[model samples]
Target chain A: MRRWLARVGALTAAAVLIAATAPIIMADDLTVTRGAGDGGVAREREIRDIKSEIHRLEQRVDQLENENGQLKKSNAELKQNADKLQTSTTQQLSEIQSRASAPPSPADFMDAMNRFLGRYRFTLVGGAAGSYIYDRKSNTNTFALDLEPIILWQLSDKLLFEGTIEANLPAGSSADYQLPVADFQYFLNDYAELVMGIFDQPFGDWYEDQSPFWVNRFITAPLPYNVGSLIPPTEVGLQLRGGFQWGEMGQVADYTIWSGNGPGYTNATCGSNTPPSPLPDCSTTTALVGDTLVSDNNIRLNTHSPGFGGRFRVYPLPADSNFGRLELGASTFDGKWLDGFWLTSWGVDFNYFRDNLQARGEWIQTYRQMPQGLGADNRQGWYVQAGYFLTGLQVPLLPSELDQYIDRLEPLIRYSGINQRATVLGNVITTPGIGFTGSPALYAPHAREVAVGLDYWFAPSIVWQNELDLELPRAGGFYSDTGQAVGAYPNDRAFVSQFAVGF
Target chain B: MSRLIKFGMMAALAAIALVPLAPRHARAAEMTPAQQKRQMFRRGAQLWPIYCNTCHNARPGGEFSPTEWNMIIMHMRTQANLPPQDANAILEYLKASR
Candidate 1:
C-alpha cells in the first residue's frame, strides 16, 4: 500500500511538471521547428502542437469557472427576490382579511340607510264628515255623511304631487266619487313655484286653501260659494305663484297667475223657479259647469284661451306687530260665458288673525255682455266671518285629559249675500210659472244669508260644527230645504249640526 | 305646451340663480333668535298655499300653541303620510311661528 501510494504520488508530480513545461517548450521550439529538416522538423512540430492544444484547454477551463460563479450568484439573487415577493403578498392578504373582519362604523350604517330611503316619500290624509239639518220651511230633518281621502307624494325636495277623492258615502252616494284636485307642483325656490293639473282656484281663501270640514264652523258653504254658484271654485289649470317678504315687518306678498278651462255655460233658468227638463228641449243648467259640460254651455273659444286670471295678497302688518297678521288681496279673471258672452270677474278679500280671534271677508263682482241685443249686467256677492276661540276662557269643567281631545270651543258668525242678474237672449223658457212669461225681461234677485254657529274641536283635525242659518230674499230667489231646492221662497231658516274628522 | 313649460322652467331657474346675488336684508345668521324664528315662520307659511287649501281656507297656525301643533302635526303626519324630513321642518316652523 505504501509503495503504490508513492508511485501514484510520483506520477501526479511528474504529470504536473510536464504540464508546466509544455507552455515554455512550445515558446522556445516553435521558431526552430519551422526551419528544421523534414525528419527533425516533424518531431518538433508534433511537440509544439501538443503544447498549443494544452494551452487552449487551460484557457477554456478558466472561462467555464467564471461562468459557473456568475450563474450561482444570479440564482441566489433570484431566490431572494422570490422570497421578498411572497412576504409582501402574504402581508397584504392578512391586512385585507383583518379589515374584512372589523365591525362597520356608524357612518357606514347611515350611508346605507340614506341610500335605501333616497327614492320617494308618500302621505295620506283621510277622514269622515257627518251632518244633520233642520229646515223651518219644510219642517223636515235630514242627516248626511261623507268620506274625504287625500293622498300626496313627495318625489323629491323640489317636487310635490297630491290628489283628493271625496264621496257622500252614507247618503248612498258612495259610487258618486269626486276627485276635486290632482295636482303637481315644482318649486323653483323660496319665492316661486310652478303648479299644474286640476286644482282649486287661486282666488280667495274660500277656494285656494284647504277648508277642512273639521275646521270650519258651518256645515254649508256661504251663499256666493254654494254649489252651482257664480264663481269657479275649482278648475284645471297651470299656475305660477309665490310669496316674498317685503316692508319692515317681514310682510309677505303672495301672488298667483293661472289659466284653465273656464266655467261652463249657464241657462236662463239657472236661478229661476223652473224645474229641470229633459235634454234636446232643455237648455242645460249653465251655472257651475263641471268637468263634463253639455254642448250648450261649451263656449270656450280655444283650449288655452278658455280662462285666465290672477290673484295678489299682501300682509300689511309686521309678523310680531301688535295687530298680528293682516292680509289684503285682490283677484280678477276674464272668460267667455255661455252663449259666447264675454264675462269678467273681480274680487277683493281680507283676513285678520290674532290670538284666539280670526276675521275674514270677501267681495266679488261679475259682469257679462249678453248675447244678441241684450245689454250687459253685473252680478255681485260678499261675505264676512269671524271666529273666537273660548279655550282662553279656561272653563273649570274642562279636564286635563279632555284638553288633549278638545283644543278649542269657538263661536262663529257670518253674513253672506248674492245678487244675480242675467239677460235672456231668447224667449225659450219652457218650465211652467217661471221667468217673464211673454218677453225677455230683466230678471234679478237679492239673496242674503246670516249664520251663527259654534265649533267644538276634539282634535286639531276633528270637530263638531253647529249652526243656525237664516235665508232672506227679496224679489225672486230659490231656497233649499235640507240641502234640496224647495223653489222660490221669501224667507227660510235651517239648523245644521256637522261632525268632521281629518286623519 | 311642452315647449312653453320647458322655457318657463329654464327662465325660472335662471331667475332663481340670479336672485340670491341681488341685494337684500341682513343675513339670517346675523339676526337675533326671535328674528330668525320670525323669518322661518314667514318662509314656512308659504308651504300652506302650496300643500293645503285645495278645497277651503287654511286655518291659522296661531290658533294652536307649539305643544298643540306637535299633536296636530303628528296626526297629520300619519294621516297625510308626510315624509319625516318635511314633517320635521313643518313642525319646527309651526312651533317657532306660533
Candidate 2:
C-alpha cells in the first residue's frame, strides 16, 4: 500500500508542474509571434487557445487527485479485509486445539453409558434354534429358544464383577431360568486373582472360556461337555486364577484352583448284600443306602467336605504371534457323592488359533462309586473340532464386497464319541412299595457323532449358525433340545439352525 | 529412620491401590503422547482377557499390521458395542506393538 501511495504522489506532482508551466510557455510563444509582426486578431486567438489548454491541464490534475483518493480507500479496505481473515484463521486454529484437548463430551459419556460404560460391558447372546431329527419310529421337527445375558462391571483396574443369566426352553418342557455364573474377581497382580461366587466350572476350555453361543463354532456341545455327560458345568465356589508371562511371549501359563459344593447322587442303593447269586437273600450284610442325585450343588448335602478342582494351561507359542497360538490344558475335580461315595473327574484339552484357522480337542472322564455291589460307573468322551475362514484362503473368484462378507463366514467340522458303563444299577430296585425300577441305560448311551456346520458372523458378537449332526450305531435314544436323552431313537441325524447375538 | 521407612512403604502401597482405581481412558487427559501410548498398551492387555478370551484365545499382536488392526477393531467394535475411544486405544496398542 505504501509503494502504491508513493507512485500516486509522484504522478500527482508531475501533473501539477505541467499544469502550472503550460500557460507561460504559450504566452512566450504569442510574444514571439507579435515581435515578428503578427496580426492582433491572431494574437487574441493564441491567448484564447493558451487559456483553454491551461484549463484542460487543471481538469486533468483534478481527475488524477480523485483517482489517488479512490486508490487510498481501496487499500484501506484491503488492509481491513486482510486483518479480518488473519483473525478468523487464528480463531479457527485455537478452536481446533481446544477441541483436541477437551475431555469427553456429555454425549460421548452418555453413549458410553448406553454401551455399558468404559468400565462396564453387557452382552446378550443365545438365540432361537430349530431342529429336524429322524428317529426310528418317526421324523420330527422341533424348535426351542435360549437366552444368556451377560454383564460385566469393572470396579477398578484390579477388581471385576461378572454375571450371566440363562433362560432355556427345552423341547416338550417349560422354560427354565438359571443363574449360571455370578462372580467377582480381585486381581492380586498381573499374575493372579481371587474369584468368589457362582462361577463356571474351570475344568476345561469349553466350560470356562469357549461355551458362549457367539464364540463356539458348533450349535451343540460335544457329549463330554453337554448336559448329563457327568461333567459338572458350573459351581458355587471360591477360586484363585491367574496367568503368567514368560520371556518375550505374550502368556506362558494360565491356572485356576477352586473349591465348591460337592456333587451328590440319589436312589443309589438300599439293600444289604446277600450270599446268593441273585442277591435277594437279605440276611448277610449291612443295608446300603442309595445315593441322592444332585446335579447342581446349590444346596450342600454334605457340609463337611467341599468339591476341589483345578485347571492348568500352557501356551507353547507367543499369545500374539501371527502364525498361531497353541495351548494345552488339563483339569480335574474331586468330590464326595450324596450317598457318601467318592467321585472324580479329569480332562485334557488342546486349542490352536490363528487369524484364519481354529482347532480344539478335549477328552474327559468321570467316575462314581456304585451304591450297591456293582462296580463304579465309568463314563468318558472325546471330541475334536476345526473351523476355517473361507476368506482367509483368498479365493480369486470372490468380489471385494463378497470377500468381506465371506471373511465373517466360518465352516466347521467335529467328530466326537461317548462311552458309558453305568446302566446295571438302574435295573435293580432296592426300595420297598415302589414296583418300578427301569433301566436308565439310554440316558448315557454310547455313541459317536460327526457334525458339520457353518457360522456366519453378522458382527463380532452375532452369528447365524446352521449344523447337521449324525449320531451312528443306533443309540438307545437321541439327545433332546437340552442335550439330554429323552425319547427313543435307533439312529439320529439332525439339522439344527440358530440365530445368535451378543451385546 | 526405621519408622520413616515403614511410613514410606505404607504410603507407597496406598498409592498403588489408589492409582489403578482411576478411569483408565480418562487418566490419559494429562499424559504426554508417549505416556498415553503406553497406557493404551496396558489397557489393551487388560481387555484381552476380559473380552477376547471369553470367546476365543486372543490373537497375537504380530498377527496383523496397523491397518489390519484398525479394520478388525472397527468390525469388533460394532459387534461388541465398544466405545469409539476405547476402540481407538486398543487400535493404538496393537499398532504400537506391531
Candidate 3:
C-alpha cells in the first residue's frame, strides 16, 4: 500500500507537472503549426497589422513632440515682442508729457489778438481848422480856431457808436463847445438803420453833409443855415434812415424819418421899470425864438408833444452815370411851439455833381402861428451854391509850383437870401442887444448875400479857403433896444480866410 | 393835426417793420467765389465815387490801412445812410485798391 501510495503521489506530481507543461507543449506545437500553414499565415498577417499600427503610433508620438517644442518656441517669441512693445509705449508717453507745459510767446499772443480784433474795431477821426475874419460893418478883425473830433466804435457787424465834439475858440471871446453828434446806430437790414441820440437834423443836405469846416468849400455857412435860421441844426431823438435801389436803371432813393424836440418860443415881457440899457423898452414886447442847442421844447414851453419830420431824396439818374449824380430832396418838420400855436417848416433841396463841379441849392419856408390874434409870422430862405475844381485847366505857362497850386484850386460861388415878412410882435420888431458888430444884421427883415470863394486843397481832407461876401439888406429898419428906430440897414463886405484839416 | 402826425408815424413804423417780411426777388444762379468777388469789385468801383463824392472828395485808398478803412467805412455808412451791400462793396473796393 505504501509503495502504491508513493507511486500515486509521484504520478500525481508528475501529472501536475505534465498538466502545467502540456499547455506549453501544446502552445509550442500550435506556434509550429501556425508557422507552417494557412492559420500561421493569418497569425503572421495579424502580427504585421499590429506592428504597422505600432509604427504609425510611434510616428504620431514623434510628431506630437516636435509640435510641442515649436509651440514653446513661439510662446517665447511672443513674450519678447510684448516686452519690446511695452518699452516703446512707455518712452513715447514720457516724451508727450514733457512738451505739454510751456508759456506762449509774444508772436503767439499777437496772432491771437489779431484774430480777436478782426471783427471789432475802434477808431478816432476828426477835423481841425483856423480862421481869420474881417467884417466891414463891424470894423473888426478876428482870429478863430475850431476843432472837431469824431469818435467811432464799431461794436459788431450791425451795431455802431459815433460821437462828435465841436470846439470853437474865437479871439476876444469865450470858447464854445458843443456835442454835435452822439448816437448809436443799429442796422435793421441792408436797407434800414435805427439811430438814437443827438444827431444832425436831416433838414437839408448842407447841415448833414457839408457843414464841417473841412467839407464846406466856403468859410461862412449859407444864409438859411446860420444860427437861429428856419431849420434846427440838430435834434435829440430817434431816426430811421437808409437808401435803397429805386429801379433797374441804377436809380436810388434815401429817406430819413425822425421824432424829437422841435423848436420853442420865449415871450419876454419888459419889466415895469425902464429896463436896463441893453434890454428892450417896456412899450414893445420881444418874442425870442428859442432854438439853440441846449433848448428842448418841453423845457422851454412845457410842450410835451414831440416833433415829427422826414426827408426823402431821390436820384433820378443812374448814380454811376458819367452825367454825375443828381439828388432831389424834400423835408418837412411840424410841431407845436406853444399851447395852441404851431411852428411848421418845410424845405426842398437839390444836389448835382458832374465831373469836377458840384452844385447845390436849398429853399426853406417856415410859418409860425402867433397867439392872441397876432396873426402869423412867415419866414423864407433860399441858397444856391456851386463849386468847380480847376483840374481840367492846363496852365503850362505858369511856374511849376504855381501850376500845381492852381490845379488844386476850386472856385465857389453862392447866392443866399432871407425874407422875414413880419415880426413876431406885429409890425414892430425889437432888435437884440448889440453884443457884437453884426448882431443887428442877424435880425434883418430881408437880407441877401453873394459870396465868392477859392479853395486850395493840400490834400483831399486839407484845404486853405478864402471867401468874400457882399451883403445887401432891404429898406426896412428895426427898433433898437432903446426903442429908437434905426435907419436903413447897412450893406457890408466881409472877407474870411481859413485853413482846415480833416482826418 | 397831432393825431394825424401820430397816425402817420405809426404807419411809417409799421411799414418799416414789415419791410423785411415782404417777398424778396428771386436770387440769381449760384455764383462761383471768383465770380462773386469780381461782381463785388465792379459794383464797389461804380459806387465809390457816387457815394464818397457826395460829402467830400473821394479819399485815396492808400490814405488808410485796411483796418482803418474798416472803421472809417463804418462811420460813413451811418453818416451817409449807405446800405450794407453798398457799404461792403465800397469797402472791398478800397481794400483791393490798397
Candidate 4:
C-alpha cells in the first residue's frame, strides 16, 4: 500500500510537466503558421495563459494525491485487521482439535470409562461347552454342559478385577456361581513384578494360557502338571515374578516364580493321603444332601496350604523367524488328608513348541501315606502329545482370513498315559455335598487315551472347538470307581465341543 | 537436646525403612509384556476410596486414562471395595494397552 501511494505521486508530477510543456510547443507551431501574427507582447500573453492552466492542473493533482493517501491508509488498516483475524481463527481451530482427539500423554487408555474421569471396563463372555465322558461303572455315555459368563474391569492402573459366573444351562443348577480373580501387581521394571490378591501362580507352560488343544500339536496337558493334583493354580495370595532377557544368552528365555495361597484347580483335589476314596455315588440319591460327603482333610496339613512354584523357558535360535520354545517347570504341595497325617505330592513338567508342529507332555507322581493301618498310596502318570496343523499349521493365516472360521480350523491329536499305582489320578472322592470329590480317576476311568479334535476359530474373539476322543485300555488296564482292579479294561468313546471368547 | 533426640530417632527410622526403597524408586525395572502391562496400572490405581465407588457405580467403561485414571484412583486406594491395584486393573484391562 505505501509503495502504491509513492507511484501515484510520481505519476501526478510527470503529468503536470507534460501539461505545462504541450501548450508551449502548440504555440510555437501556431506562430509558424500565422506568419508572425502578433509581436512579442501577444506571444508572451499566450505563454502566460499556458502557465496558468498548468498551475490549475497542479492544484488538482495535489487534491487527488491527498485523497489517494487517505484511501491507502484505510486499505492498509483493513489488511492488517484481516491478517489478525485469520491468525486468531487458525489458533482457535487448533485448540479445538487438540481438545478433541489426542490423549493427555504419549500413551493413552481409552474405553467407555476412559472418556469419563474414571477407570472403567465392561466385558461379557457367555459360552457353552459339552463334554462326553465314558464311565466304567455305568458302562454308558455321559454328557454335560459348561456355560461361563465373564466380566473384567479396571478402575485404575495398579488394580484389576475379573469375575466369572458359570452355570449349567439345562438344569440351571447351583453349579453356577461367581468368583473374583482380581490382582494388583507392583512393577519393578519391564521384566520383574509383584502381585497380590487372587491370581494364577506361574507354575509351568500348561498352567499359564497354554490350552491343551490350541498350542502346537498337543491335544492335552501332560500328566505331571494336570494330575499331580499338585501344580496349584489361581491362588489367593502374593506373588513375585520377574522376566530376564539375556540377548547374549539366548533370544527368548524367561522365568517366573510365585508364592501365594495355592488353590487347586476347579473342583480339583490337593490330597496327600487318599481322600477316603470317595464312595460311589452310584447310589440313587444323586440329589446332594447336607454335607454327607464333605471333604475331610485326611492329613494334618490344613486345606489352605502354602506352596511356591516356577517355570523356566528357553527359545532356541531366538532371532530367527522359525524357532522352537523349550520350557521345563515343576511344582510341589504338602498337605494332609482328612485323617490328619502329612502327605506330599511333587511333579515335573515339560513342553516344546516349534512352528506349526508342536509337542507337549508332563509326568507327575502323587504319593499318599494313609493314617494308621491303611497302606500308602503311591502313583504317577505322564502323557506326551504332538500335533501339527494340516493347513501350514504354525504359519498364521493371511490378513483377510484372520477372522474367518477356516483360519482356526486345524486337525489335532494327542495321547496321555497314567500309572495304576497312582490311584489318586483315577479315584473320585464323593463329596457328600458337592457330589464327586474332584479326583481325576473317577471322571476318567481308563489310564490312557488318544484324542483327535477338529478346531475352528470362527472369529479372532470366538473359538469353536470339537474333539473326538478314543480311550484304549491295555489288556490289564481296568479300574472301578472303588479303585478296585477290575476284571478287564473296557474302552470308551465320545465327542467334546467347546466355545471360547477372548475380549 | 530432646528435639535433637527426636530427630535422631526419626532419622534412624528413615534410614532403616528407606534403604530398600531407594534403589527401586531411583531405577525403573524391566518386566515381561504381561507383567509390564499388568503391574504399572496396579501401582497407578492406588487412589479409589475417595474418588470412585460412591454414587457413580463402576459398570463397564467407567473412567480415566490408564495414566490419568491412575490419578483419580490413587486418591481412593484404601477402601475395601475398591482396593488400589484391584481397581486399577479393572480400568486398565478395559482400556486397550496399545
* Candidate that scores best on TM-score: 3
lDDT of 3 at A247: 67
Candidates sorted by lDDT, best first: 3, 2, 1, 4
TM-score of chain A of each: 0.63, 0.65, 0.69, 0.59
* Descending-DockQ candidate ranking: 3, 2, 1, 4
Indicate the residue-level lDDT of A17 in model 3: 61
Each prediction's RMSD to truth: 14.6, 14.0, 14.8, 14.4
Q: Which candidate model has the greater lDDT, 1 or 2?
A: 2
Ranking 3 against 4 by lDDT, winner:
3
The DockQ of predicted model 3 stands at 0.42
Model 2 chain A is weakest, by summed lDDT over 10 consecutive residues, at A431-440
TM-score of each: 0.60, 0.61, 0.73, 0.54
Give the residue spans of candidate 1 off by over 4 A.
A1-118, A170-174, A266-304, A338-340, A394-407, A422-444, A473-488, B1-98
> Which parts of model 2 are misplaced by more than 4 Å?
A1-138, A266-304, A319-323, A392-406, A423-444, A474-488, B1-54, B57-98
Each candidate's interface RMSD, rounded to one decimal? 9.5, 11.0, 2.6, 15.2
What stretches of model 4 exceed 4 Å from their correct place?
A1-113, A121-143, A169-174, A178-184, A211-234, A248-252, A260-301, A319-321, A332-346, A368-370, A373-376, A392-408, A420-446, A475-483, A487-489, B1-98
Per-residue lDDT tens digits for candidate 1, residues A479-502, read 210112222444677777878886
| Candidate scoring better on DockQ of 2 and 4 | 2
Native-to-model Cα distance after best TM-score fit, residue A247 in candidate 1, in Å? 2.8
Error of 1 at B13 (Å): 16
Question: Between candidates 1 and 4, which one is better according to TM-score?
Answer: 1
Candidate 3 stretches with Cα past 4 Å from truth are A1-120, A266-302, A396-401, A421-443, A473-489, B1-17, B21-29
- Give model 2's share of reference contacts: 0.06
The window of 10 residues in a row where model 4 chain A has the poorest summed lDDT is A287-296
After aligning candidate 4 to the native by TM-score, how far in Å is the CA of B10 from where it should be? 34
Candidate 1: give the TM-score of chain A. 0.63
